[model samples]
Target: MLLETTPDTSAFMIAGYTVAFVVMGLYVASLFIRNRNLDRDAEMLKTLFEAESSPSSKKEAGKSAKKPAPKKKSVSKKK
Candidate 1:
């Protein structure tokens, strides 16, 4: 009589591969979403910073444009 070999279990290997692919897909998607959100935040912050700084700079420029009064010369001799 010839001896026959039984096939080994492969379901566990299939399940592990499936889980690994699913997790990697989810991680890539999450990274994409996070990068998009960060880009949006950066744009918003840049606009906000420019909006805040421009007015202050303009006001400072206007104030500095005014002629200042001349100071009188004072001589002090220290012995």
Candidate 2:
């Protein structure tokens, strides 16, 4: 009777699973970091927007907008 035995591949399987989990963990961690950064940026932008929309800033913007352009001096042509 000739019987073939199955080869042991458990070690390779474990290694592959470990590598996959590690990569997944790193990806999830990076996503968390990016989400936190985006939230922080959103808050910062909101504050800046509020500051720009304030009455004091509006008055300053209005003053600048109401200014007239300076007259340009023309050069006299010599014949």
Estimate the TM-score of every prediction: 0.58, 0.59
| Candidate models: Cα lDDT each | 0.61, 0.63
For candidate 1, give the lDDT of residue 21. 99
Off by over 4 Å in 2: 1-3, 57-79
lDDT for 29 in candidate 2 is 95
Q: Per-residue lDDT of 49-77 in model 2, one digit per residue for the tens?
A: 55555556566775454333222223212
RMSD of candidates 1 onward, in order: 19.0, 17.1
TM-score for predicted model 2 compared with the true structure: 0.59
Q: What is candidate 2's CA lDDT for residue 70?
A: 26
User: Model 1: residues >4 Å from true position, as ranges?
Assistant: 1-4, 57-79
